[model samples]
Each structure stands twice: as structure tokens, then as C-alpha cells.
Target: MTERPVTQFGPDFPFAHDDWIRHPSGLGAIPTDSHGASVAVIGAGLSGLVAAYELMKLGLRPILFESGQLGGRLRSQPFEGADDVVAELGGMRFPVSGTGFYHYADLLGLETKPFPNPLTEAAGSTVIDLEGETFYAKSLGDLPSVFQEVAKAYDEALESGANYSALKQAIRTRDKARIKEIWNPIVQAWDERTFYDFVTSSPAFQRLSFRHREVFGQVGFGTGGWDSDFPNSMLEILRVNVTECDDRQRFFVGGVERLPQGLWRRAPDRMVHWPKGTSLQSLNGGALRPGASAIRRLPDGKVAVRDRWGREDVFDAVIATCQSWLLTTAIDTEESLFSQKLWMALDRTRYMQSSKTFVMVDRPFWKDVDPRTGRDAMSMTLTDRLTRGTYLFDNGPDRPGVICLTYSWMSDALKMLPLPVERRVELALSALEKIYPGLDIAGHVLGDPITVSWEDDPNFLGAFKGALPGHYRYNHRMYGHFMQENLPPSERGIFLAGDDISWTPAWAEGAVQTALNAVWGVMTHLGGRSHADNPGPGDAYPEWGPVALPD
Candidate 1:
């Protein structure tokens, strides 16, 4: 193992997994007699599961309420009759930089392989289609000179406008002070600007033709086309890049859903209220309570939650891990549960539309050498056509392979919102048919295709929050909710936890980090104190909290 550096956050501020289990969580233990104290946890996603697991270890009973499946956005759907073949409907790639999330993945013994990102080795080969032209490449060097120029311009802009290198170094070293110093300035400058504004405004891009910008929008670096994110806050894009959220990406071997499912049945080495063999699955008697329909604060300083089936339960505290909008739409929540300022933040949270259509093939035919060109039969594709990004997942030589025919966002996704799964698949194939003229893509398809339009799903109105320009104040209010020391007692117990509440919105690491924050908040609320040696998030919040919004 590499020597873990002791940073200002004590080797754990960013990840926190090591500190959580290495020593006694500095939380004051719950009273032995009060081990039966029950806490209501809204949503059974990664955030809620983690918070419940930790709280259970600390002797508090947690009753989970989930409107959807347990994994939340980590939806992994296996193809019919091919259990080994799965399509990741949401959150396919995960960066290794998300060490907090990796801690759980490692603990669960889940296997992962490098994701086939564009221009990466795992992709084998890449095909770029734009303006009635197609370019095939083994690497970026293989692309045309114009594409190379665009990539270079993007790098130059980041260095000149965002101090990319310095910021990366600060984050890599976990130097909170240095990170804040570098990040706060960029946030102030870019928070109110759109990503397109930053790119087009750059002198590097201006030196080239408008076509360069067009190609950059269709085949951006790290991931794929970023044109869909053009209207989002520049800060959102910068956060993803500087934090390495787009680098060294990997996907779970069987399914990304394993992380949350594993935690549901995992038995910690030590626990307070339950026995050594106790698991969340066993504690809940094998099923989660139905989705929460209503939540109200009782006069006795407790929380009352009613499920869709009208099953009501009262608890000393509540941890709502669902999307913010659900608090208003799906669940009838009391107005007093949150301050008006908080409600504004929650109501204004903007979720991006996303759609993905996938199909399973008999084999990884893309690996076959083409008799004519001596290249792979097919390559991971990026096109300005209707299909923006296409991914190929090779299960194995014998098992069926999965192909994400079309993965689009925003306007691109909304265009297919009303279409059926079959029609969506047809449209994607029609676009791809134009790119790979003679490739028998249809003949290779083995089973029915699966499709998802996140915006159409009531549980999650959209894929993830894409903060618009000038929305940092709202985000600041939401992210700072766990720090309720100054808030009234009525607002103290019902805490919020989810990726949307984090600075880096779409990543699982954000969910894990924010869940830890709620864990600390709940512990403190229950009169538990952090152990003197291993301080919780609240104990160390002032010294290493999120970068504050600049004036």
C-alpha cells in the first residue's frame, strides 16, 4: 500500500473512510438504555444507506423509507434471460479519485474495470462523426489537426483562466487552506458565467474558426460531447475537471448497484445496539418501509412520517436523502420543516434531463478485426448527430455484450422523452447506421433494448442538479444544512443528505461525503459526542468545511 500522507484534514477530510473505521468515531456513545431509539431515514439510496449503517453501528435504530429501488441513481438493470449482462441506466463511470466511495466498494469486494472513455486505452478505438465527415482514431494523435488544436485550446484556457494546475495540486495534497484560496477566487469569477461563455471567451479558442468550437462541443476531452452542459454554470464544469472526476474512470464488474446492496446486508465488525451478526436487511426484516408520502414535525419535538400505504411512524429524528423536489411534490412536508431560505434553495435546485438507450449483443463483436482495414470492427463513438455518445461494454468473450446506443442530456434527451424504448433504439441505430455504413449492428443485437428518460420519472424529475449561473448562494445554503448548530431546535433533527447537497453534484463521492456530514449531525443531535481522538465532521467542520461562497 502507498504511504497515506497526513494532510491538514488529517488524512481523511476528503475521503473520511479511513478515519471513520480506523479509530473510534469521536461521537459520544448513545445511552445504553436508549439503544432502542428509532430514527427515520428517508430514501434508501447510497447516502441514506451509509447514514443508516453508521447510525446503527452507533446504537440507533434506523427505519428506511424509499420511494424507488434501493440503489437510487445507481440503477443497474440486467438484460432479460442474461443475468450476467447488465445495463447501467444511471452513473456508469466512477473516478478512482472518489476514494470515499471506493472505500465501500473495496469493503464490499466488488470488482471494477476501466471504463471505455473516448481516446483512452480501454476504448480500444474511437470514432468521431461531425459535419458529414467521420474520423477513426486509436488515440488523440490519430485525429485531424483541427481536433488537436481544439483540445490544446481547452487546456490552455483552463491553465490561463482557472489556474488549473495549482488547483489540482492543492486538491491532490488535500490542503484545505490552499484549495479554498484557489477555488474561492474561481467560484467568484465563474459562478455567474456559463460554460459556453468561458470557452468562447478564451483567446485560445478565438484563434481558431467557429468550426473548432463546434467540434469541441461534440467531442470534448475526458468524457464526450459537453455541448449539453453549455448552459450550466462554468463552476460546475471546472469542479468536475479540477477534482479529477472525469479521470481514471472505472465501472463495477457485475453492477454498480452492488455497493448499496452490499451495505444493506453487510455486518460491521462491531456495532452498538445490534448483535455481532446484525445486518440492515435482518434488522428491517428483509424489506424497506414503503415510500414516504408525508412528513410532519410533531408538537413533542419528534418527526412523523407517513408512507404511501398510509403506514405512519414517529421518530426522534429524520434524515431525508431523497431529491429536494420530492419534499414538495411527492411528500406532503410541513412548511415549518425548513426555513424559507432553505425552501428557496430546494425549490430552485435545477436537475438536468438525461436519457440512455442500451441494447445487448451476442458477443463483443467490436473486437473482431475487420478483413479490409485491419482495425477493430467497431469503435466507441462520439457524434454531433442525434446520438451524442455511444459506449460499448464487453462482458466477456462468451457472455453477451452491452452497448449504450445513445446517452444524451438536456435538449437532446428531451427530444426522445415521448418516444417508446423501441423507437428510441431505432433512432439511435439510424444515426449510427450512417456512421458505420456496412456494420451489421442490427444483426448482432441479441435481446430487447432498455431505455430510460430520467425527466419522465416522477421519483427523480431529472438526472442530477446542474447549477445555473448565479446559483451559488442557493447551493451554499443547501450544502451548509448539516451545520445546524445555529438553527432553531425545530429545524435541528430532520437533516438532508444526497449528492445534490454537495459541491460536486453528480458523483457518488459527494453523496458519501454529505452522508458523513449527516451522520455527524444526527450523532450530535442524539447527544452523542465524538470521541476525543477521531473527531466527526461537525467537530472539524470550521477548519475544513466546503469553500465558502465569495462576496
Candidate 2:
């Protein structure tokens, strides 16, 4: 037998979604009879929308049910009376490593610009404030000596704790065997450890003082302040860094929401049941149905979904893309529909709290050089203060700009939950005033500020899953749901797809990849098959599947 090619993602199992979709083998076709079969897709977010669109191409009729807005957490709130100026309440940045999600963005013809992450070229300059000491610099080299030490310590810790360089090279070369060898051991070692434990226990971090760890927590490498993630599993942090999820970030030009909306309206070259020019919009009569309230299995084995108004629809299969918490709260999911093991996985899933506040400025005033130091007056700020991290967006020198006054998580986010938009803005401004001393941030504000506390939102419950120590078994169960061929028929039809179900949560690529997994599951359930040359995940599972977790 010919030797099979090694999997792309190896033990980390990110799901080589971009590779699979664009492969010459193609996703394959369904039987002509299966073309018009209805499939219920809950939540019109990136995952649901992508799955529905791909299924439509494969001859399946996907009926999307969304309880909230179509974009779900990819929400872009426009400034009052100013359509162009907006705030991204969720999922603002996209990383280049998320090739799978970008495939859809490319197909949609959406433009992207580099996100202004701290110390990146797009940020121009960055300010680091800790314990009443403030430092401003154009790049990492310009920061204080202690900051450089923190960066070096972090690098050394990764190299020591996890053979960082070898893993990076393995990932870069797509050396699946080497990647599995390096990553599997790390997963075993770190799966039960918190990020704080990894940091404090590392030899490199131990050489430094407690202050070093505190600074590292306040202003983390790549992104800002990782104190929010200190309680999460070290395995989760390692996956993010090794995959380069925090690097080379970009943002959708208009809004991330455009990706899903564009897909909804896009007319593909060919579709299974619809005419040549048909789009999801046309199929649904320009609107998605109301949210799904209940899901159960029918007597004949079909999945029955009920809308908010008690309207019932039965389909051959169902793909739930909503947050897992909804299974108990908003939706009356049948207990028998899922195995107790699967139910435990869904119930144990933990979501992190996040909050963001944005204010529209008259223009990119931060571009102006300060007369005293010849530096941009207001650099993208990362501080231990109440604001945590502040980002500035430049539409142009003359056009309106947006400032994310506070992008915080966990306790920081919870503090702002009780406050209204105006009060939140006031706290952020007060914090910034202490940092700048003389800048008039309030004067340039164009309209009312926009804010979001993801925890307050009923549909989401929280921002995204932050796997706790000892949660690997739960994650393993959730991520493996798409591979249901071995599952009993009673547990087969209802599929799960979302960032929350992927190995790497909070990234859009996770959502896209899981959607593809569900697509494969639905196609197979409906008597469809991927082409022999281009086998789907089901065909490749035995050889290239997710890493097996120890019970």
C-alpha cells in the first residue's frame, strides 16, 4: 500500500480546513436524490453560515435558525447616525495563521487591514504603564530594561518548558511526525497545569523576582495583559502561541460581520437544488427564521427542531452552532438526544467574561507628533490601570477614527457590567487622563460610546471557552463529536460546530474548521460521500485524527 501523507495539524489538531476545502479531490458531491434534503442549522454565525453555504453547494437544503442577530458574536455596532464609524463589540481581530477563516473572507471579497496590536508596525507606538511607572516607545527595543527582561524570560520559559524553537520549526515545515512528537509530550505534561503554574514553576521565571511575574501578568507578550488567562490551562496557552494565533493580526475593513452577511447573499457558481443565481438570501426569502427553542429526535429518527413560536420542523440532521450553555438555558434540548458523556462535556464547558468600550473620534488625532518628544501624542496603551488595554484605529488623517477605550477580560470585565455606557466611558477616560495628563480625549468624541459585556448577553453567556486545568477530557469529547460514525444511531444525527467545540477557542478559524467537520458529518449522514481522491475528515480519521486523550 502507498504510504499515506502525514496530517497537517498533527497532535494539536487544528483541522486543516483550508487545505481540505481547496484540495483537488474536492469536498465531493451528494446523490441527486439527497440534494433537496433539509438540514437544520442553528445559529447564523460564521460556523453555521459556512456550514450552510457549503452544504447548499453539496445539494443539501440548510434551514438556518438564529435566536439573535445573524452574525452572533461577530457584532459590529455602528456609531449613532454615522454608519461608517463603528465599534467591534466582539471578534475584532483576525490572525494570518487562521488560513481556514480567511478562505471564506477571500471568497467574500472583503478587504482587510492590519490590526494595531501593541508594538506592531500598525500600532506606530505603544505605552506600557505598571505600578505608577509609565514608559513610551516605538518598539520593543525602546521599552525599559525590565520590560526586555520580561520578554526574554518568557521566551526562555517556552524554550525550556516546551522546546519552543523545535516545535515552531516543525509547525513551519508541516512536519507532522515531529510536531506530534513535540506536542503530544507537552500536552501530557501541561494538560493539568494552569498558565500561572507553568510560569512560576519554569526555571527561567524562577531566576527572576516576583515583580517579573507580576509585570508579565500585567503586560503579556504579543497581546496585552494575560492575567485574564492565568486561570486557564497551560495547554490552551501553548496551543495559541505555537499556532501563532496572536501574531500578524488583521481586521475586516468594514466589519467582521460582512463575512457572514456576504456569504448569505453570495450566489455560487453551482448549487445542489437552487438555480444558478440563487443565494441563501433568496432561498430564505431575505431573512433567517427565528431562534430554535427546542430540539428532539422524531419517531422516524429525523431531528425535530422547534422555533420560538412553537413552529416545528423535522430534518434529516441538525447542526447546533450556538454556545453549549444554550443547551440548558435558552433551548429545551431533549435529554435522550445526546449521551450522558456528551452532555457532561457540554455542561462542563467554561466560558470567559469579556468587555469592550469604543468611542468615535473626530479624526486620527493620535497621529499628531507631540511638540515635547516628537512622538505620537496617544500611542496604543497597555496599562495595569482600570482600562487594561486601549487601541486606536485610523481611518485616515481626516476621516473619523475609533478608539477602543477599554478591552478587558475576567474581573476587569465584570466590574464594568453594572455600569451603563456613559459611566463606562467616564471610567475609561479618567484612566486615560492619568496616563496622558494633558490630552483632551473627551473633546474629540463624535457620538455616544458603544460598549458590550458579553456575560450580560443571554445568548452567548460569555465570550468564549477558556479551558480550565483537567478539562482536556471534556474538550476531547466536544471536539470529537463530528466523528460520529462509531457512535450509536441514537446519538448520531445532531452535530456540534463552533469555536467553543474546537481545540482552539475564541479564534474564528476554529469556528470555520468545526463547521467543515459538521458539514462532513451531515453529508455522510444523508447518504453523501466525499470523492475517493478528496476524502473528508471521516475518511481520514483513522490516520489523521485528533490526539487521543487519556481517561
Candidate 3:
């Protein structure tokens, strides 16, 4: 079957740059530095790569260092050909919301596509009842009402009988506008606050609204799984920023990794220190993986590195452009003064237990794969009552008989199960076959399973830290937290970057911000003029939403 490109919607929404993107463009102010400057970027994931790419634009020859392949969360495991269009084992699917990510992808030149039909047409099924060892095939669009129905029953219990309103302010309006004014605000809040807390706390839940229970009805609504103690408020933040789209709507074009892939191909020469399997011991005073003396920080600051027992080189300035947790841990005491404070911020953080399950199917689940990627991992929630899988995606292959596998995210109770790799694979395959009944998913031959446990990966304990209730206003202040304090350009040389420092929390978007922050930090530090002045200081993702109520 021939593939057709789906139309994209509002900017930062989906199918980015498809004339539908509505978010504002421009990086808000990341100026280029003087000519021929040296820079070192640590961590080769989206954040590190973006930082390096941005540095190149700034006239600084930037070098990127990593212990693994590029794309950190955005990377995949081919287990085969270099360009066999590797299957994504990491980040997948972009939410219509999450403006920062959308904004960053567009800037880097990635395209978006529309969603699929029957919805289940993409994948024969979407639900796997692992708890009961059952399979549930259904469209997620039906979710909103599903939860509403369940909430209706829960509402009755919360109403306190006659003259009793579960809503805190004693108000109720189903109107979208009314909902936006009243309910939407509530939704936004609950979304960011943490579902567990909101479930346990929100007066609204006690008062119950149609939206409250409906959230769980939606696939990811109870995303962390209704069983989770974590709050939905944080997820709500990502939701609030997302653009709402119609059902049978998704996208993918010329391959989903186009943007990041392009950035790499376009500036391959600029990327340095891209070593595979050469893990670091620690970082300090502008140096990476101290010990063995395989690292060289040249007089100009261009980091020259070798494998575990390789060679050496130099670099001018080092842009710690990965996750703050990794960078902070690697940094030795003295040189890393803010370690304690940064560690505090990290400590205050929380994250959902999520895992990615990449499956190579025999054909396009839908007529086409969505161009955007994020939140495709399989998940389970309450009201919406999903069976645990949260998302799915394409393998980026164009062959006719190819089974472009999808990466599903499992959070909540499902993530807690400490099963072995073989057992996990069997469980995932069983789940896939059950939910996607009638599909030749299991029959599809070839390829051993390749998975990365971000939820368990030692370097990163979670798939990026989550901001807890009331953790904001200062959360991004720490991780991905950008401080515009000015210093001479030279003094700004040691720049701290990474998605954690950029407020986007472990996503590519945050990485871009960190790059801008680090370089901008350097500019201000140098006393030299930069492209755009600090609009002030602090994290950038929007903050106005209210706590979320479990749907």
C-alpha cells in the first residue's frame, strides 16, 4: 500500500511546520559568540547535540562527548543495518501540546503527519489486560466519555447527596468555554500537580466533575496508572501545553527522525567525541570522566577524547549539555560548587516508572505513521482504564514487507513489575498479540529485542525527573534552570546545560533551551553583548495551569 502524508495542525501541536504549527518561532534570544571559539558538549543525546549544533551556529567549534550513541532518549536499536531505518527504542510521538518540544523540533527542521483511522486501524488493538491476562481492543477517542461515565457514578458518591457539590467552589459548567474558565483551569492545575496527590487531595475529585473521571477514561489520563501515588498535575502541564486534535488524526513523513537526523547530517563535521560504549567515570573543573588521562582540554577548549583506554586532546569551553543529574554526579567536588543545590533540586524531583517496548510489526499499523514523536509509550490509568500500554510508533522503514515496530511506554503498576528481560519480552509480545488481536504481530519474524530501561538505567534513575506539586516556580530554577547572571565571556566559559537545566525535563525541547542558556550564560558571563538579552531569568515552559483532577 502506498503511504500518504497527513496534514499537520497548530504549531507545537503536530505535523510541525506543516503550515499548521501555531506556536511562536525564534529561540527567544540565543546570540552567536566571537569567531573561532572552542566548546565541548557533554552527553550526545538530543540536548547535547542541540547544544553543539547551536554552538556551531555561534561560530564556536563545539565538540560533543557521550558514553553511548546519539539521541539519548531519541535514539533507537537497529540490531541490524546502520541505516536499516532503526526502530525507536526511546522517545516517540509528540503531543499536540508540549509547545517547547514542538518549537525546538521545528527549529531543527523536522516535519509532522496526521493520526490514523478506526484509530485501532493503526494497531489492531490498544489495550492489554495484563493484570487479568486479558486483551482489550478499543479506540482511545472513546476514552473521554468512558471516564465521564465512570466519574458520573463516582460523582454520585462525592455529591454528599442533595445540595452537595463535589467541586470546591460549588460550581459546574459543561460548556467548553465555561470548562476552560473553570474546569480547564482545574484541569491544568491537576495536570501539573500530580495525579496521586490530586486524586487523594483535590476537592473537585471529592466533588467530582465529568472531566475528573474522564481523564482516566483517556489512555494516558491515568497515564501513571490510576494505581500510582504520583500526581497528574505534572502530566497536566504537558497536557495543557499540548494542542487538542481530532480522532483519526496522527502523522509521519519521510521518516519521523528527520529533524534530529537532518541536524546531524547537516553538521556531521561539527560533532566531536561521539564514542560508543566509552562510559565516563566522572566530571570536574571543565574536565570529563576524570582518570586514566584519556581526556584533553586544549588551551582553546576543544575537548579531545579517546575510548576507555584511547587518546587525548583539548577544548576551549565545555557545555554540560545533557541532564543536570548526570553532569552534577560526574563533576568532582571543588569545581562543582552548586552540586549540593543541584542535587537538592534533583532530590526534590519525581518521575513516573515508564518503559519503552519496541516491536517490529509486519506492516504500517495505520495507513501511515505519525511524524511527531513523544508519549507513545504504553500506559495504564483509572477512569480511562487502559491495560498499561501508553504509546506506539513507526520503525522509520519504507520497505513494503517491513514490520516497523513501535515503542510502547508502560508506567504505573506495570512498570513496577521487576520481571527479567526474557519474561518482559514474553509479556510485551503477549500483550501486543492480545490487544492487537488478529494482527500478525507475533508471526512477524526476525530481530531480537533491544530495550533500554530509562526507568531503571543507573545513570538516569527515571525517564527524566518529574516536578512535584508546588515544585515549580523554582523547579526549572534548578534542573534545566537557566540563570542569566552576567560575567565576562571568558568567565562564562564553563557553561552548564542539558534538558534538566532547561525546564523541559529530559526531552529534546529542554535540551535546546539548555544550549541557549549555557551559551547565553557564557555571553553574559563574558561581559560581551549577545544576540538577545535575558528577558530576565528563570525556567521557560508555561506555568499558569491549575492542579489536575483524575479523570
State the C-alpha lDDT per candidate: 0.86, 0.88, 0.43
For model 3, residues 1-551, the per-residue Cα lDDT tens digits are: 65332222111111122211122332223333345455656666666656555455444555556665555667645645324444555554444434444654666566665432222455433443433333233544544454444445434433432122322222211122322343344434433455455443545455656445434333232222333333434433432223221223334344445555545545332222332222111122233332222334334523454434454445555666544455335433122334354556655666655554444444443443234522222322112222244344444445422332222234533443475555556665555555444445556544555555566764455666555565553353453333434332223345666555544453454455455556545444434343233231222222322222343
- For each candidate in turn, give its C-alpha RMSD to the true structure in angstroms: 2.4, 2.9, 10.4
TM-score of 1: 0.96
lDDT of 2 at 4: 29
Top-scoring candidate (lDDT): 2
In candidate 3, residue 516 scores what lDDT? 54
> Per-residue lDDT tens digits of candidate 1, residues 85-157?
8899989999987777887899889999999999999999999999879999999999999989999999998
- What is the TM-score of each predicted model, taking all chains together? 0.96, 0.97, 0.62
- Please give the lDDT score at residue 392 for candidate 1: 95
